[model samples]
Target: MRARVHVLVKRALSVVLSLTLLATINFSAHITSAEAKTRKPTIAEINEAKKKEAEKKAAADKAKAQLNAASNQLKVLTAKAVAARNRYLQELKKLEIATKKAEIARKKEEAANKKSNAAQVAVVSSKNHIGKVAANAYIMGSGFTDFDSILHADGPQDLMDRLSTLDAVGENNSSILLRLKVAEESARLAKIEAEEARVEAVAARKEQADATARVAAAKKEADQARAAQEVEVKKLQQMQDKLIAELLSARKKRVTLEQQRQLAILEEALAARAEQTDVKAKVWPVNGIGFSKGRTTIRSTESIRTNAVAFAKKQVIARKPYVWGNEGPNSFDCSGLVYAAYRSAGLGYPEWDRVNSRIYYSWTKRIPLNELQPGDLLYYSYKADISTIHHITIYAGNGMMWEAHNTRKGLLYSSIYSIPGLIPFGGRV
Candidate 1:
């Protein structure tokens, strides 16, 4: 019984030492993580991204303004074109009236010339007939000679009277022939004047015809001009439509890019949060009094092992300076501290040798964070802008965590909110 009691006492002492060690290491780790999170990004990078986003939005707005201006201009142009077309139509109507007047003037002049020509022809024919009648009458009067009349007379006195009468008749025939010749000359002169009038009328008619043709040509040209204007108006309308479509497409593209960027940012924030929550749920194995190293412990009949390799690293890097790029002993980066902590928890540490790695696995799919059992790997990001597993802390239940961080603070206990930008993501060994 003495031997058994001694053995029990020794085991209890061992348990106490183990529990104290685990608690000390855990506390130190939390302090380190909290300190590392305090380090921040340079102001230049932040300002540059903000400026870029602002410039893009401003450009989009300017394009929208330009599009509106173009649409207004198009409307103005359309109105002007419509007014011009109406004016052209009015002018065309005037030209048509002028053309009709010119044609009527031409026809009247031609008819006057035709009537003058007919009058001249009739006068010429009358003169010719009068001359011929005078010649025939003169011939008949000459045939009645004075010698025959004297021979056939009964007495000398009767012969004398017959000669006197024959002489008077010859004189009358001569007078009639002279009058007929004069009348023929007058008729011929009238015919010549009529012909001259006819020629003048024909010239006037030709001038009128030429004027009518000119008016027709002018109207045709006006019509052609109106058609050309219509075509130009159509082309301008099509161009305006095309420009509007292009503007709309550009605006749509800009909106889509903005939405995509926002979604990406939100997704990144959620991913960081999930990783930290998983890290928080992880439990280190304790051997009755303290955490055990190099051995599996049973709690609630479930066997568990701390990440022995990670444990060794923490021991090696405790109190290391918080260097941005340092990975080991005398100095540590954010991810380095987290990596070391996980190893100490007896979980198989993934080979996240690079600062940027794609290690997205859902530990909660099998074991939810709300029902977090022991031995889960609670992950986190010190700089949320950094990769998902930039820094980590072990979750001790009740809103407490442990981490190893910068040499300035070493390992310590930390509340969840102690790290300024710490976000929780969860994983399992």
Candidate 2:
């Protein structure tokens, strides 16, 4: 009975395993069917969606540009206002110096007037003293009767003393008068100088006051200008923010779709790997060449040689530096480099060089980045210049990209993140 039970258990386990296997197969088949139904979008759907997205992006870009222009204008106005304010302040400083000088001059003038009046009084007193000394000399001479007789009768010492006394008296009177005259002249000159200084100081003060008023007026104007500019900037910012939000929403939707597509592709790859018994060597569609090369060659040729050369060229230029306007030899501008490299290959590039040209419609729509093998076209947009695609690069796999950039750094390979404003679009050749 133990052996019978063991056999029964083994049978039950086998049945369970079989059922499990069958269920797994059925589930896998169902998944496969669902996947098949949800395959990549058809060309028409892609084109339509792309068109819609392009329209929305265009609108967003226009709004952004307007906002940027307004911002720039506001900056210019602000600078002007600042300059005006500085000029007014400078005038005010000059005015202040002038006012101080005027006050000093007035004080000096008052002092000079006082000195002049004292000097005048001294001059008058000196003249009166001289008159009194002359009268006394006359009276003394009269008392001597005859001047010659008195001279002869007197001793030589007496005559000498008399002459000496007369000389002393005359000298004292002359010295006092001379001193008084000098003082009076000095005072007069001082007064004149003081008055001139006072006038100059007054003028300076007036100028200073004017300057101060001007500065105040300028400040008021500057303030008004700043306020106006702020209002304009705020309005512009609002518009820009609204447009950016819309752009972000659209980008999010696109990202969602892209994620879904990537997930689906990953599922398919896993399924294929599971079913395959033998691992096959993975082959690149365009050997030795990259997406950039194909894009470059496609501009000039439709031949197979063009495609091959483009591929080789891209591989060779994959490590080139990026230059804003560089077209060859190690650097490149976005579209120019892309066109040049593809032209080297046999693939025909878009007829128009501009990003917004009608020829890009098909390319932008049907190509998804994950579906890109080799020789896919890459588009890049500048967030600053959203109206046009400013750059293009070839995908070099391994998270590397090659492009011709500005003059500063010619053709070069750069991480996508290194570019501040780059928005990427992947498309097939």
Best by lDDT: 2
How many backbone clashes can be found in candidate 2?
A: 40
Instruction: Output the TM-score of candidate 1.
Output: 0.30
TM-scores for the candidates:
0.30, 0.42
Location of the lowest summed lDDT over 10 successive residues in candidate 2: 279-288
Give lDDT for model 2.
0.55
Q: Compared with the true structure, what per-residue lDDT tens digits does model 2 show for residues 1-429? A: 234323533555676546534544443343233322224544455455566667778887887787788778778778878888788878867766776777778778888888898898898899889877767656866443236434655787877776676567768977998899898898989988997897777777777777678777877887887788789778878877877777777765664565445444644554444344111111111111122222322322235334633553453435566555545555555665655655566344445443431244234333433343344544544321224345566654323355555657665544322343232235545
Q: 144-233, model 1: which lDDT tens digit per residue?
A: 466667667888998888788767756755665566566556555655665565565556556555655655565566556656665665
In candidate 1 the C-alpha lDDT for residue 181 amounts to 61
**What TM-score does structure 2 among the candidates reach?**
0.42
Candidate 2 residue spans exceeding 4 A from truth: 1-55, 89-171, 254-429
